[model samples]
Target: MSASQALGGPSRCGWVLGPSLDKIIKNVAWRKHSQLVAACKSALDKLDSVVDDPVDPASCTPLYGLSTSDTDFVLQPLIMALDSASPKVVEPALDCSFRLFSLGLIRCEIDTPTPTPSPSPSPNPSSHSHIFRLIDSVCKCGALGDEAIELAVLRVLLSAIRSPYVLVRGDCLVHIVRSCYNVYLGGMNGTNQICAKSVLAQMMIIVFTRVEENSMMVDFKTVSVAELLEFTDRNLNEGSSIQIAQNFLNEIVDVKSKEGIAESKLCLQLEYDNSEKKGEPIDGEPGEGADLSGYSKIREDGFMLFKNLCKLSMKFSSQEHGDDNILLRGKVLSLELLKVIMDNAGPIWRSNERSSVVKSVDTSVNLDNKEDAASDDLCISKPRRSTRIVIPPKRLDSYLWAGRKSREQGKS
Candidate 1:
């Protein structure tokens, strides 16, 4: 049994531990390739199984039981396997590479034992370039592999776009977007072009919705966003690009509106009850509290996006020759204009609401412990918690704001 199995973890019957595996990898030549490939898969499988503890969170302990030197010994052989001409060796190897890459564990940190003295070429490739080649292989898999392989490749590709390393994320986006446009330039593979466009749209939504300013900064220099926008503008009716853009815009507007309300609500009580429990004196008076206009930054950022989207709508509007395209463009244009007007009007409306609600009320008028007593006699009684007010009316302000903005823009 291997060390992993000795520790009561999963392992194959003939599993070899680190030193034996290392000897096999370093000594095995290309002439006797089957043993080398099988050994490589076994090492990867061991690492995979080490990470399969029910006790540990998924992908949380990627290096699990392996030391720095041992990890290098394991991964170096697998990188070598990528050069093999045999599909049998390449397929499983690629799958393992994708698994490790997706978990952000493909690159072993330099602190690991037997560190590379300097960067070297293929057969002794550096970690970064190796990962680049691995993902590149996955992208090319679609041409020869089935839909399952293609989608698995795309899924891993998308995860890379969300990587913590800014450069890595940026490069992944550039590859996908450029590949899509390159297909168009090559004037072949309509299916591949459609696949690329769809993935691009999904990727855009993920970035705009889930990412932060730092990630957005990384994308500013990349051609992906511009290429995707150009593709949409030129082939608006050819694929699902237009609908994707429209849906993305709607989601952004909806999400921004929700955040505005949640983050800028009226504070009913200035002093939180928890501070009183800890016997700490709170600073604020009965009414003076955090600014209700706290959502200014959010509004500003959202408005910038909304403005850019409206510009896109205008561009599409100019090219509308067909009745159907014109109708779709008009609907999107109307929503975009509405987004602008709503953003402008929000602060004014919020200011009025703030002023009206700023007046101080006697704290004593609120529900007290004495009010909960069943008997009239003044005795200690449990405090009744405040009843939450539920407003039943559906919020139609966002919809109305869009309509009003469209009308105003039309008049202007």
Candidate 2:
């Protein structure tokens, strides 16, 4: 019988293998499912200690263990029910699989034939597709799970970022970017290393560029104006001469309050309003929705940061302000900081004005698909959630040297 049929759903595990492994869910009670997990884990264990090197591909293979037939059976049921599975069992199991694949305990035999039409169709179009599925699913699960599961995933994540394969590394980086982005966008607070305080500070600096520029073309008309700004402005220009003026503006409008709100909430509110409006049904142009449709507002507010500094400069320029060189220098620095924000954030002073560089980032699928430069080892450079860990180079050399020394000493 086919693996899917033999191992389809709860029946196979419940009636066939439950007596031995003893993981029948009772309430959800997937018997054959547990057996499948065990079988998958056993196969994965067999691949442990396999070597991975481009010059010696066999070094990374017990290729016979993870054939196409095996992963198909394993992935199907688990994914279909992942969202519904009890967190206690499923999260840990998925974590184990993720770590197994990352550690090379689970050997995979991929048939990456040349791009040609063949008489028999392949079950999977590409060898790397399953690896993608595993990473995607586990991250999705991690996104939904509690602290423990997410932390477990982070550990496995730190491992996958070290993978040798281009596709795997790229996929892991995308996950890392997404995961970090979600934490920030999700309104998470405190010093979580996975997201990190310093990184958030850095990202806020990165975000000061307008959504169009930072998103590099992803189009934030899909996002809100407030969110776009909050995600970007991370307390830039902290200790310059504009303190009184920035404070006055802050007092006038609580700019920081919006930053505290999560994008998910904003997105939901807009969704609710859309739903209510739809129920009545009378609108034109969809009201431009929540995103900022024009540059005037951002320019107006951002230039407010410059206004006080500009006043100070005007005083300096007119020689009204004495050679209290520190004051003059502070004014110059404040204006410089404001200009940086404006250039990066992308708001036009006049409709006819042109920026030398377009503020749009190339947030294209194509960009993520390409391999990331070695930002660190194992970076595929995709913009998902990712992490980094230090591994000693010549790792396998240490293993080989120790093994060889042991054999020689024994012979002596």
Q: Compare the candidates by TM-score and give the number of the best one.
A: 1
Q: Pick the candidate with the highest lDDT.
A: 1
lDDT for position 269 in model 1: 15
Model 1: lDDT of residue 320: 37
lDDT of 1 at 107: 27
Report the backbone clash tally of model 1.
4
Name the runs in model 2 displaced over 4 angstroms.
1-65, 74-85, 106-127, 169-176, 187-412
Error of 1 at 48 (Å): 9.6
TM-score of 1: 0.36
- lDDT, candidate 1, equals 0.36
Determine which window of 10 residues in candidate 2 has minimal summed lDDT. Answer: 356-365
Query: Model 2 reaches what TM-score against the true structure?
Result: 0.33
Q: Give the alpha carbon lDDT tens digit for every residue of 1-412 in model 2.
A: 2354322223211222222122313323346456545554443332232222336322222211234444454444344334444565555445544444443333322222335775654334443455455556666655663655554444444334322211122223434434544433332222222222223222223333322232211221111222222322233323331333233222222212111123323332332223212122111112223222233222222222233323333333323444554343333332233333333343432121222111111111021212332121211111232222111223322322333345346448
